[model samples]
Target: MLHRCNEQLQQFSHVNKKALDQYVNFTEQREELQKRQAELDAGDEKIKELISVLDQRKDESIERTFKGVARHFREVFSELVQGGHGHLVMMKKKDGEPADDDDEDGPREADMEGRVEKYIGVSFTGQGETQSMKQLSGGQKTVVALTLIFAIQRCDPAPFYLFDEIDAALDPQYRTAVGNMIRRLADTSNTQFITTTFRPELVKVADQIYGVTHKNRVSRVNVVSRDDALDFIEHDQSYNAE
Candidate 1:
């Protein structure tokens, strides 16, 4: 009877072991399914974010293209009119109304007009400045010209800037201000600038200097070494004093 009881106990122990193994397998399958569902959810969220980014980029591209075209038009008109006034206008539909006015039906014209109005600003200088252009001392006119040119440049920055005699008429203080402003613009826009001037003070700030003079009716250009250029200027001043 003791031997029989021992055999039954062994059988019961084997059955419990098999049942525990099945329970562990079911638990593993449930955890794997949960993990896979989380991965799917994460992938869906990433796709949604990518779509949103792409849509934002598309809208930005469209807006920039419109602004660029408007800028080109303004430049052309200003050039043609010799810096005279020009206007850019845009039309938009009233809120809660159809996109078209009495003149047209489609959305294209309204959209175009809206973009034009949205991006362009009317720019003008005082008549006093223009009228005094000639009578104003060279220094004053230089300031005015630089102000206008800088204002236009600030409106739409580019990769390069060319300035010829911009500070020739400025005083020492104004010249320093102009230089500082140039450096600021360079820092902000990654712009490279080349300016030509007869002023020694201005040339001191230049990265490179080219000296041009007419000799015997022929134009001669020399890349001036900084020290040599300074010595030459001193020699010329001494001779003038003598």
Candidate 2:
């Protein structure tokens, strides 16, 4: 019996060494994994803060651009009009946004994406009222639309511009203002403007003028004197009748 017990004890000693080695290796690996996880957790907050700051900077950029355009629009509108002003109205999401497809709350950290939009609006005290596009008169709407285009271009100008009878709806005074505005813009920038108009005011501002007439059922472009251009505008009925 003593000999058998000694043999069993030797076998148990070898088995215990192998098991202990495996346990030690597992403990080391687990500790390393935990340390790595802690490191990642520490960096996570910084990454989220960076994202938030970048998002805020993006919003500020948009806001600055919007304000610039709006200011230019108001100035142009006033130049093209006698009274009232315009705005580039910004609309925002007033309610909390749903975070998930099921309408669950989204991650608070990722919520900085744009939840706002901007729209153009105007008011005409000359009309004795103030309202959106739906309530504005034809001339009012035309002036507003034109001023908006001019504002956007002023902020980010194109190489050139093409306008088709943009002053048709305005009165003589306003038409002349628009024509002067075009001339000033042309002088300020290298951008050229090709505009079509029946107003003598606009023709007077033009470097060259063309008279389009259907003679013998064919369209022809006639280079005319400033006086002749006035004749065509004032005598539209006779000009077209002939």
| Top candidate (TM-score) | 2
Per-model lDDT: 0.58, 0.72
Against the true structure, whose lDDT is highest?
2
TM-score of every model versus the real structure: 0.41, 0.62
lDDT of 1 by residue, 1-242 (tens): 99999988987774565777889999999999999999999999999877666655554554444344434444533432344443222333334222221222222322312323233322223332224345657875566556555555655667787888787667877777677667666767777888876555656666677778898999998998877776776776588779
Runs in model 1 lying further than 4 Å from the true structure: 1-136, 233-242
As a whole number from 0 to 100, the lDDT of residue 164 in candidate 1 is 84
TM-score of 2: 0.62
Per-residue error (Å), model 2, residue 137: 0.6
Tens-place lDDT per residue, model 2, 115-207, is: 323222223333434366777678878887888889988999998898998887887788888889999998998888998987788888888
Which runs in model 2 stand beyond 4 Å of their true positions? Answer: 1-58, 95-113, 116-130, 215-218, 237-242
Model 2, poorest ten-residue lDDT window? Answer: 98-107
